[model samples]
Target chain A: MSLQEVFRNCAEQRRSALIGYLPAGFPTVSESVGLFEAMVRGDGHTPGCDIVEVGLPYSDPVMDGSTIQSAAERALRNGFRVRQLFDVVSAVAASGAVPVVMSYWNPIHRYGPDAFARDLRAAGGAGLITPDLVPEEAGEWMEASEEHRLDRIFLVAPSSTEHRLALTASAGTGFLYAASVMGVTGARESVSDSARELVRRTRAHTELPIGVGLGVRTAEHAAEVASFADGVIVGSAFVTRAEREGQDGVCAFAGELGRGVRTASPEPAGG
Target chain B: MTARDLGGAADPDELGSPDSGSHDPDEGGHFGPYGGRFMPEALIAAQDELAAEYDKARRDPEFVAELDRLLRDYAGRPSPLTEAERFSAHAGGARVLLKREDLNHTGSHKINNVLGQALLVKRMGKRRVIAETGAGQHGVATATACALLDLDCVIYMGATDTRRQALNVARMRLLGAEVRPVSTGSATLKDAINEALRDWVTNVADTHYLLGTAAGAHPFPLLVRNLHRVIGTEARQQVLERTGGLPDAVLACVGGGSNAIGIFHGFIDDPGVRLIGAEAGGHGLDSGEHGAALTSGSPGTLHGARSYLLQDEDGQIAEAYSISAGLDYPGVGPEHAWLADSGRAEYRAVTDEEAMEAFRLLSRTEGIIPAVESAHALAAALRVGTELGPEAVLVVNVSGRGDKDMDTAAHYFGLVPEAGITGEDQQ
Candidate 1:
């Protein structure tokens, strides 16, 4: 299914979409595929995650915290290549979840954006979420994504001005990634107060789904974010859980977060 | 005479070709195929603002006058170009000259870049400055400048470097800057940069990220090179007056390629003068434990710019090792990569053993102790000198003093006493 379809389905169900992230080839290539499969299909309790963001590991993950950095390091050490990202994506997409790629821009540039977008689309991937690429420098990627009919997701940070927020919202297609904190990606104890304000400001520019990420760690945090956001994106938390609990741990944790998104009281329209 | 008078005109672009415009980075911050603004959405505006401000500051007469005054009165500019006669006998009898950047305030050419950026921070109305350092020379310089300007300063150093260069860490603290030790990602220069970038993004409103070297994103490579261009300009005129002509070769150590680019700028348009850069060949290129990015690396992007980098087959950046902390980086400045690829400069790798020998040779022969980083250039000079013969005139940029490298030098040479320690503890 397309990323838009996934969000439409979540909106129909009166629940925010649950998006889980895992670096492809972490621990091992085959094991990461298994972990991703678990993230898509829950333990027969709540609905499985709505979307999966397969991380294409880069050498310097400047936006990542230690958890994701170590995971990426392990993945890179285990001979994770960009081609292996397709394998992970194909498996996750086969399980009926939208698989989007979250990568730094250099790998795509180095790997050739057109070829990467073509290969990813052929592998049933939905789109790309470039953490470090802004709208101004994304012309090449935008053309490639357009050629492949892939969604180009861009980020809107809490530090973004209204002008920047508008520019990003217009440039983005799949969903607008709203960073919940001003710092690098980590599971913080409390979400910044600015996140909600940022989401509100971004909503003034576009009607597209806004997914909140970077600091959401627990079911409670996910539920809190889901009260307002259209999607709840969890990355380092899933990687950390998968590190300790394996695939079953990923399912249990993702299931709980999925339940949280379902149980949260949605905010009033335009509130 | 004032120090500025000894250096001729202070116009940075005057020494280079007016028609070529070779020194300026293109509008997109690219130097040929290397360098661009590969950054997050949050930093595009900041980077653009910096690039614009730097463009204005470079052309502003008042800004130039103020910076020239600081370079003269505050940071001790017009550092001497000394003729190393005694040391020349070992370099195949070549006439060797040393650009004495070690004589500058804070004991390194880093002062040149630091003062320029600190002045820009003040001009931007930012009250706080943050920086990342590996060997702590850049950190010390930044802290010194911040203290002089009364700007709040925070320096990030890798946990490993903080321990290895504890004296420098103390010096930074004494300069009233907060030192934060980053314990992530190989615990080195790259990690410190990551931490500093994080700080900059988080505190973009009131802080300026004072990047030390010529590597990182846009405006930095151009800004840093311009700030330190005086090294090459002064050395060029001094060499001309001393030798009646340009040297056959100009050599400097290349980590992030700041010192080398600084010295190379004056002679870049002069096709006759060979520009040589010596990189750290930690153990040896064959041993796979080295930081010879230009010699052993491929074109890749790291730390926000496309540059030659040591990486694995899958494009993961590999850890670079060198006895000199400053030279132990996996990536080179994008402009250096451009220079190497364009045939404007030649780069060679000098092994740790060779650099140490050069370090010892310079001290014993000329009574001048060189930083281990600079010793790489000295080792390269020895080879290039022998190849060029006795009539060759060469200028080597002594990028920093060896005072901060005593521990490493003592450890390398076994200069410690029976107690396995040196200094006041023995006294």
Candidate 2:
């Protein structure tokens, strides 16, 4: 399913879509597929995630906190290759969730953007989430993603100006990733007040679905973000749980967040 | 007299051109297809603000005048160019003129960029300055500038560097800068840069990341290079005044290529003068233990810019090795990559052994203890000098002094007794 369809589906249910992320080949390549499958079919009843973000492990994950960085390091150390990402994406798509690859820009640039886009489209994947690439430097990606009919997601932070927001919104295809705070990726105890404000401000710029990420830790945090965001994107929390308790832990947490998104009270109007 | 001078990715073939535009990176900061902003969205505003402010400041007479005054009276500008006659004897009797950046107030060319950026920080109304360092020279320079400017300073250094360059750590603390040892991702220079970027992302509103090298995102490669351009400008003028013409070739060591780029800009417009950069060949390029990004690496992005990077086939940044802590990096600045691609400059790798030999030779022959990073260029000069023969005039940028490297040097040459220092300490 396309990302727009997932958001539309979640809107019909009156709930925010739960998006789960796990670095490709974390722990091991073969095991990662099973973990992603677990994320898709969480708790065996309600779907765990409408979308699965497959991380392309990079050596320098400057935006990642210790949990994700360590996981990526482990994946890279285990000899995870770029080709393995295709297998993970294919598995995630077969399992249930729309699979999208989250990668730093260098790998895609090194792999050739057009070829990467073509191969990804062939693998039943939705698109790419480039954490490090801004729209200003994404001329090739813009052209390639357009040619291949893949979603191109770009992030906007609280620090983004109105000009920047419009530029990002226009360049983005599938959704706009709203970083909740001025920080790297990590699970925090509470989602900041700025996240709601940022989401509201972003609504002025683009009509695309907006996903709130970075520091959406507990179900409470997810629910709070769900009130204002179209999608509650959880990454480090799943990785942190997976580190200690493996796939089952991640599935259980995903189920909790999945339910939380449905039960959230709407944010007060103008808040 | 003023430093005002000076001057990835994509389609496996559609990015970075040898001749892109007039301003090198042009407006959006692209050199050929290398060198553009590759930072997180959170930091784009900061980068843009920096680029905008720098654009205005370069043209603002008040800013230029203040910077000039600081360089002249504070950092000790117009560092003399000395003739290295004794040292040149080992290089087939070539006439070698050394740009004495080592004689600057802080003992290196780093002060040039640091003071300029510290001023920019002040102009931007940011009170806190953050930086990352490998050998500690840049850290010391940043700390020094912050102290002088009365700005709060925090430095991130690799945990290993903190141990190896402990004295510089003490020096930073003494200068009132907080030093944080980063223990993640090989615990080296690149990791420190990552940590600094994290800090910048978290606290960019009141902080300015005083990037130390001419690598990194758009404004930095341009900003740092412009700040250090005085090196080449002064050397060019000095060489002309002293020898009546341009040198046959100019050589400087390349880590992130700041000093080299700084010096190269003065001579870049002179088609007659050749620019050469020496990279660190730790064990050797063949052993996969070297920082020779330009020599053996491929085009890729790391630390916010596209350049020649030592990376795996999958685009993972590979660890760069060098005996010199300052020269240990997996990536070269994008401008140097452009220069290499355009054939405007050539780069060669100098092994740890060759650099150490040059380090000792300079000290014994000319009473000048060169930094191991600078020694790489000196080693290259020795080879190039021989190739150019007796009448060739060469200008070598002695980028820094070796005071911070005394411990490493002592261990390498066994200057200290066996019991005083162990091989494990060197490691």
Candidate 3:
């Protein structure tokens, strides 16, 4: 299913979509796939995660917080390869949720963007979320994503200028990722006050669905962000839970966050 | 990303501006296709702000005047070029001219960039400055600059470096800078840079990442190179005045290629001159334990720019090794990558044994204990001198003094004696 369909489904349900993230080879390849399946399984009533962000573990994850960085290190130390991503994606696709890959630019650049895009699409993945690649440096990525018909999600920060906002927003083919705070990816006690303002500013540029990520953890945090954003992304929190508790804990948290998005009455479409 | 076809080294006339020198990168901060900002969106504003400020400051005569004054008065500008005749006896009768960056305040060429960047931090109204250092020379210099400028300073250094260069750590502390020893990936220069970037991302509101070398994200490589251009400018004129013409070749050690790039810029326009950069070969290139990125690596993104990086086939950064802590890094500056690719410069790997021999030779011959990092250049000079024979004139940048490295040097050469030996006993 397309990212648009995922958001449209969530919109029809009068709620925001839940997007989950996990580095592909955390602990081991087989175990990581099982964890992803658990996240997508939901509470059996509502979808656990409308989209799964399959993180490609990289060596220097400068943008990641301790929780995610540790997980990525563990994944890499366990001999995670680029080909392992397709295996995980193919497995997650069978679970009835849209799977998107979140990676630093180099691995894909090294793997060849066209080959990566083609393989990702073949494995039933929806798109890509590049945290470090800005639109200005994405000339090749832009063409490759276009050729493969993959949703190219780009990010905007609270620090982005209006000109940059318009440029980055227009360059994104999938959705606009709004970093909730001016920091790296981690679970925070509360989402930043700047998230709503950033999402509001982004609305002025494009009608693409906006997902709020970075510094989002608990169900309350999810509900708080879902009130304004079209999608709510949770990453390090789930990774943290998986490391501490097992698959059951992840499922329980996903269920809680899945319901969390529904608890808050979203702003009116025009509002 | 696929290598963008940025076609060969651009000619000034082809760039459509005759007055525009070949020293500057493009407006996008790309040195051909090798240098561009591959950073997070959150830091885009900071990068843009820095780029804009540097653009304006470089053009403003007042800013240049202030910077020049500080270099002259505080850091000791126009560091003398000395004739190393005694050391030349070992170098195939070549006349070796040593650019004495070691004589500068704080004992290295690092002072030039640190003082300039510290001033920039103050201009930007930032009160705190954070920097990453490999060998602690950059850390000590940064700490000294912050003390002089009255700004709060923090330095991130590898945990291993902290142990090896303990004297520099004490110096930094004395200069009133907090040294945080990073224990992450390989716990070396690469990890130190990673930790520094994290600190910058979190506290960009009131802190400037005073990057130590001519590597990293956009505006950094460009600005650092510009700040260190004085070394080249001074050496070029000093060479002509001393020897009636430019030197046959110029050489400096390359960690992130700061000193080499700095001195290379002076003779970049001199088509007849040769530029050589010597990277650290810790064990040997064949042993896979070396920091010779340009000599043995491929194009990949690391730190913040696309450059030649020591990375695995899967694009994972490989840990770099070197006996000299300062010359250990996984990547080279993008501009050096451009120069090597364009055949404007050549990079050779100098093994630890060769570098140490040069380190000892310079000390015995000229009473100058050069930093182990600079000895890499001296080692390359020995080779190049032999290749060029007696009539050749060579200029080598002794980028730093060796006081901080006494402990390592003592250990390397077994120079350490028993604890209670008197001077008379030795005689």
Candidate 4:
């Protein structure tokens, strides 16, 4: 199903979906696909994950944390290229779960806009998440993505002004990524209550479903955040979980997190 | 502005006049095809932009004027042509002239290239500069240029190097450049280069990738070498005033090969003078540890340019090992590879022990503690002196000062004798 349909159902049900981010080509070139598959679909041999983000590792990813950076280097050494990233997306799309490409515009720009769009479409990519691409300059990519039927996800943060929030909401499709914290991506222990309010405010800005992410952990944090946003994109913890429980731990974490989102109370009446 | 300029995919010849390199137009940047812009379809535009702009900038009067102004006022140019009487005395009573590039403001010859590139950055309307550094020297030089120009700057370094050379990290931060520790493969200078290339590829429109040496992709080797040619150019004229004639030989160490090429260019056709490139042999050539690419490597493409690379049996570039971070790359500058083949410049390697011995010898004898990279050249001079029986005069390019190497040297010599920051130690 389209992420929009999934989002609509998510909104009606008052729950969130899981979006797990992993650096593309991590561990090794050959292992990345299998690892990704395990995270998205349980093969009895692998763990079933929800939405996935495959990061196109750049030479200099200034905003990323250590885990993602190491993952990128391993991927690069394993012969991962801009075009190769699309191939991974194609392989995942064939299996069922949507694949999201998380990258900075430099790689996209370095890869060229037209070729980048074409490859993303050819791979049946569900969407894109470029944290560095501001909404003011997002229209071109948005239009191109729409032409290819790819969801161009935009990030909404507490620091985003009202004008920017509205503009970004209009430009984005499929989902609006609501950051649960104020800093760069990393494994954090907790998020502030203001994150929940930001998600609520973001809901008022667009009919689009919102995914509250960044620093959201714990069943309580997930349940509380699920009360407002359509989804909770937990990246670092799953990466941490994968590191901790290996493949087994990742499966359990994703499976349990998916269940937690579904059973959590959607109403802010917890107040 | 795009990758199309880097490879110039279709008519790549259009990227340069072929003459932009020291190659003939018919050859198309071919040092017998071992040198040309052999890159992916993604890098063409960036290379093309740099090529076109660099051509104009090289000849522009204002660019030249600005470089001159900085070299004079900011960097303290016309660095003396000091006569190394004591160091040369035993060799046959013939004098040795030292081009004091070490005396430049940033403590090395790096400032010359950095100043020129910084001026070009301003002229091109770029507001930020990014570079990769192995040793903090290039980062410091690049940061100095950015600060002087008031441009935002960022430096990428390998995570491993950050611990190895924490002082450079602190120095870069003081210069207002953000020192980003890259956690990529082995986290050394090459990874830093990869990261810096990524940054420039992403932010090509308004950012200049200030390359540290005469290596890497097209235009960089050529451009950096041309800027540093000033070192040899000034020294040549100064030496003429003091001696009334050209010296018998000119020698310098070759890593990315800039310092050698810069000094050599001034005398490429000088039949009266011999040119020598001293490469790092690390431990020794037989033991497979060295930075002497032209001496020990085969011709191959690397960093967007063709050059001699230390490669494995499968033809893949091998990891080069050098005690000197500045000389640890697997490839040599393209021109150096050409010069080696043409037999115009003699190439030799100085073992790590030999270089360190020379490093101490120069310190104790001449009171100049040279960088390991520069010590290679001095070691070569000692070899030349022994051969010529004290009658042959030689001029050595003292490319950098030794202050930065004290910590590394002190530690290596057990001068500090402190067991710290490795293995079982934690601070």
Candidate 5:
């Protein structure tokens, strides 16, 4: 499904869905895939996640928090690689849930973006999110993403100015990842007020959806953010829960977070 | 961290090393397999031009004369080679020699590399210099050079490091270099490296990347080590003159491998002089708990080139963990890799426990508190001295003073003396 379609569906439901990220092969490659399947089949792996963001691991993951860092290490020790990441999308596809592969530029550039886009699309990936790949330098993959009918999502932090936001929004297809803070990705005690302002700023320039991330971890954090954003991206936080508990624990944690946000949804008016 | 900790020996335009070819990187800046034109294609010629200019400056008699004068008058060069009789006495009667780099203006061998690089950057017409630092020692040294040169400087540091080494951070700002906190990735030295590289790439037009150790893409390792060799060269001469013969062994700590190579290169041809490197064995070598790149790491490419790297089964780089920031990395200089493989140097792993013991040992016995990084070498010296017996003489590179590491040491040793914001407490 297209990201726009996902956005439309969320708009109809009046609730932002969960886009959960687990570094591909967080505990192990086989387990990573099994986790993806479980999350989708409602077998209780990351329960209630509307979208599965299969995080492709990189040697230097600059944006990760402690939880994600540990997960990446576990996955890396299991020998995760760019070429083999497709198996994850394939497994997630088999379970029939939204697949969004997140990664850094080096791995994508190294894997040949065109080939990667093709492979991901073939494996039923819905979109892509790369924190390191800026639009100016993304010609190599931006075009390939379009060709493969995959959404090329981009991120902008609260520190980004209006001009910068407009450019990011203009270039972005799936959604503009509105970062809640100025620092690296992680769960923080509170979300910045600029987050809502950023959502408004992006809405001024583009019709593309805005998804807020970084520090939006708990169900309350997600619900609070969903009130202003079209969607919420939970990385380090969910990854944290995944780390503290096993896959079952993450499913239970994500379920609470997802249900919490969904409960905040306004009821539809009856005729 | 801040730059004041790097107070140094020479002026920015005129560093301790005379514009001698001893310091210039070749046409594109290199020393053996150690140097190369590893920058982007656009910056390649710019670096070459800088290298050529350095060559011309080296040949200039006036430049040589100025460097010589500064070496004598400013840096207090020919830093004493102290004979550690008391410590040596503990060495089972083996004579222990020390290259007193701790006496250098900045209290370490780091000044040698920074001064040379800062001088070259000025000659190359760069107005600003940037560096990435871990423990803030190299940053202080670089800041000192920039302060002396009046060059605009910026240092990238992981945010976590700033908190742990706050005094050093303040020290840098005092020296007039801006400290940029890197909040990215683990908030450690590696992230600082990434941020610094980004800064270098973006500001290439007016900036020079002043690398701290014998690592990086090319020319950096070679350029840095060559500048630092003066430490070994002087020590070697002093040791020879004092003892009337070459020491049985020369030992130094290995981080990016510059200091070890600095002193090692001077004695590379001296077959009789045994060269030893002590790496950070954080916990224990048995549990894969060390930075013994030469001993445990395999030949692999990392940072910028092929070298001895601590990697996993699939060859992915493993995060280097150590009590000392300087030694927290997975790779070493290519030259050291060659040295290790060729069996030219004997490398050993010294754990934090051992290094701490040596730190305390040196402080109590010699009244000389040495940096934890340097303590590895001291511990090795202690071990080797005991093994070699009474007639043997071992020279250990006291790379730097332990003042900067005072807090860490105190905390680690459970010597939690209530240190307020006192004048004496700060490094």
Candidate 6:
């Protein structure tokens, strides 16, 4: 199913979608695929993950925290390549979970954007989540994504001005990624109070789903974010758990986080 | 996930033709396929602001005049072109002239870029400046500029570098700058840069990232190179007056390629002058421990720009090693990659041993102690001099002095005596 369908289904149930991220070929190609599959296979009552963001690792992950950096380093050391990302995406898609690629722009640019987009679509990827690429400089990527009928997801930070928010909302599709904090990706002690305001401001521009990421670590944090956001995006936390205790750890943590999104006490509307 | 067919549909060539030869970067900060603003979303506004201010500053007469005054009076511009006569004996009787950047204030060519950026920070009304250092020369220079401008300064350095170049760390601290040692991802120049960039994104509002080299994202390579262009402009005239014409070749070491590009700009339009950049060869290119990005690496992006970098098949950056901390970087400036690809310049790798030999030779023969980084260029010049013979004239950018590298040099050469040895006996 497309990412838009996933979000629509979650909204119909009055719950936010649970999105999980894992870098392709982390630890090993087969193991990372297995971990992602586990995340998507929910506890039967509620889906474990409504969507999956398979990370295409790059040499310098400036936006990533230490956990993701180490995970990507291991993936790179194991000879992970762009083709492996397609392999992971194909598997997740086959499992009936929507797969989107989270990547820095360089690898795609190096691999040719049009070819990457075409190949990614064939592999059944729903869209792309480019963390480092802003809409202002995403002309080439926009053209490629449009030609391939792939969603172009862009990040909107709390620091974004109104004009930037409007531009990002217009350029993005599938969902607008809201980075809840000003820092790099990692679990934090507290979610920034500014995130609510950012989401409200972004809503003024477009009706697209806004998924908040960066520092959303625990189930409590997930539920708190789910109260307002259309999706609760968890990345480094899962990778951190996976590093400590393999696939089983990811499965257990994802189940708990999935429950958190489904059982969240929605805040009073318009508050 | 099953592996799909290795289809011909994914043609690498479909990425299209290579970038055309352009002297300056395009609007998006690309130098051919090399440089661009590959950064997170938060810093886009800041980068745009910097690019805009740099555009205005470059055109403003008052800004130009003030910068010129500072370069002349404060940083001691018009550095001399000294002929290394005694040193020429080992160079097969070739005439070698040194562009004495080592004589500049703070003892390195980093002063030029630091002063210019520091001036910009003041103009931008930013009260704080942050920087990254490898050998600590840039950090020292940044600290000096911040002190002069009364701006708050913080420098990030690799923990290993902080230990090796402890004296330089102390120098920066004494100049009232806070020195933070980074201990991540190989704990070297590249790691320090990562930490600095993180700091920039977090504190971009009140802090200006004073990038030291002619690399990184847009405006930086252009701004830093233009700031140090005087090195070439002065050397060009000095060499012309001394030899009555341009030299056959110009050589400088490439560590982020600041000094090399600075000197090369003077002779780039004069096609006859062969521009050669000396990269750190470490043990050797075959040893898998070198910073010879142009010679051994493929096109990839790191830091903020696409350039030649030492990376694995998976595009993960590989660790680079060199005796000189300054030259031990995995990536080269995008413009250098462009020049190498366009056949405008040639690059070679000089082994650590070769650089050390030149380091000692220059001190003993010419009474000039060159930084280990500059010695890489001197080492390459030795071979080039022999190839061109006695009639050839060559100019080498002595980018920095050896004071900061004294500990490394002393350790490498065993200049420090044992603790128990008496002074009289040592003599």
Per lDDT, the best of the predicted structures is 2
Backbone clash count, each prediction separately? 0, 5, 0, 18, 12, 1
Tens-place lDDT per residue, model 6, A76-151, is 8788888788989999998778999999976887788899999999999999999888775687899999999999
Q: Lowest summed lDDT over 10 consecutive residues: which window, candidate 3 chain B? A: B1-10
| Candidate with better lDDT, 3 vs 4 | 3
Model 6 accuracy (lDDT, Cα): 0.87
Q: List the residue pairs that clash in candidate 3.
A: none
For residue B329, what is the lDDT in candidate 3? 95
User: What TM value does model 5 have?
Assistant: 0.62
Name the DockQ score for candidate 6: 0.42
Worst 10 residues of 4 chain A by lDDT: A41-50
Q: lDDT tens string, model 1, B338-409?
A: 999999999999999999999989998889999899999999999999998899999999999899999888
- Models 1 onward score TM values of 0.92, 0.95, 0.96, 0.63, 0.62, 0.90
What fraction of the genuine interface contacts, i.e. the true contacts, does candidate 1 reproduce?
0.45
lDDT of 3 at B167: 86
Error of 6 at A235 (Å): 1.7
Per-residue CA lDDT of model 6 for B1-427, tens digit only, reads 0000000123332112334322567787777777887777887778778888876676565676677778889988878999999998889889999999999999999998998889889889999999999999999999999999999999999999999899999999999999999887889999999889888877888999999888888878877877777788788889999989999999999989999998998788798999999999999999999999999888877777778989875466789999999998999998999999999999999999999999999999999999999999999999999999999999999999999888777767767774222333222
Off by over 4 Å in 3: A269-271, B1-19, B418-427
Candidate 4 wrong stretches, greater than 4 Å: A1-271, B1-30, B38-40, B90-94, B314-317, B417-427
Residue A23, candidate 1: Cα error in Å is 2.2
In the order shown, the candidates' Cα RMSDs to the true structure are: 3.8, 4.5, 4.5, 11.3, 11.4, 8.2
Report, to 2 decimal places, the DockQ of model 4.
0.04
Residues A1-271, candidate 4: write the lDDT tens digits.
Answer: 6787666655565666767777766765456676676677643533344578887776445445566666666666776766678878876777677788887654564465566887887887888886756554455577678677888887776656566678778888888887665545676777678678887677677877778777765656677677766777877676777666666666667666676677787774221
Query: How should the candidates be ordered by TM-score, best one leading?
Result: 3, 2, 1, 6, 4, 5
Q: Please report the interface RMSD of model 5 to 1 decimal.
A: 9.1
Ranking by lDDT: 2, 3, 1, 6, 5, 4
lDDT of 2 by residue, A1-271 (tens): 8999998888888888899999999989998998898888887656698999999999899999888999999998898999889998999999989999999998998899999999999999998999999999999999999999999999999999999999999999888899999999998888899998899999998889999999998889888899989989999988888888888987888888888898897563322
- Model 6, docking class: acceptable
